[model samples]
Target: MGLFGKLFAGPQVDMAKSDANRKKMRELFNEVVENGQDYKLIFGFTEDIGWFNYGFVHGSKTKIGNLIVGWNDNSQTIVVVPTVPDLSGCGDATFYRRNEIRKAYQSKYPTDAFIIYPDRKGYIGINVCDWLEDEKLYVYVSQEEEVKEFTDFFLKRFQTK
Candidate 1:
């Protein structure tokens, strides 16, 4: 765990919240994970404006909850999670890329271009972020073990099987 990770103690801090988010993430993950599913929003609210390539973009104000968005190239769809803390009150949480995320990770989860921060437990896990806006099929999973789980989930959602 990093300094902030130790300070935040993500694993102990919100295991319940994290577990709850994990369960929620799983549901959203499944939607995108399905082998036959087609174009659909996996999590947050979005329009069919078609911003990224032929794919659609999902941009919503994040909440305290965990959110994940991915493109299933085989299924030609998208998966999204809207995690906003104090939505109506505060501003939206920002994002960055993996390399970018790593920088922030080094800097302690700074919101930037297309990044995701796994709650706060060092390297125990990662907050999944769909980096479609900045780059195609580029996402960062804070949790390495969950990488494939996240990828497969997204593959099912945004790819054409």
Candidate 2:
């Protein structure tokens, strides 16, 4: 879109307040996670974690909640938990190729921001702005043991023959 086109763009859909859109996004997230992939959900608001530049780009902070981090085995891609407006009050879930990933690991900071790099071009910092936390559940799966435990629990609750 050109500059004038952007200025004339239609009103953005407020997914945060729409049930249909919320359901769609939730399903999309589930599908992304259920394909024999590994994922972690971290609880806490964006501010507490700190991805300052991203926050600035997004126009605001992520509402306090869970941030889903997942690794897709088939593509070797690390999926950034897209902001679900209705659920997160942030934005939408977006994907990035593993090669595009500059880094992916837990932040060394005291607050522990689970980070995925290439958060922004030429920028280095905690990338919390991408996830708009809203849920209360916090499930951290950083270690091998934790991943196994989470897998067991997830399969038991969500798997179907």
Highest TM-score against the true fold, candidate: 2
TM-score of each: 0.27, 0.37
Clashes of each: 30, 7
Off by over 4 Å in 2: 1-45, 48-66, 83-90, 119-161
Candidate 2 C-alpha lDDT tens digits along 74-118:
465545454433443433455655556555555557554444456
Give the total clashing residue pairs for model 2. Answer: 7
**Model 1: runs farther than 4 Å from truth?**
1-14, 26-66, 70-73, 86-142, 148-161
Candidate 2 RMSD computed on C-alpha atoms after optimal superposition onto the true structure: 16.2
lDDT of each: 0.35, 0.42
TM-score of 1: 0.27
Measured on C-alpha atoms, candidate 2 has an lDDT of 0.42
Which clashing pairs does model 2 show?
16-85, 16-86, 65-134, 82-92, 82-93, 83-91, 83-92
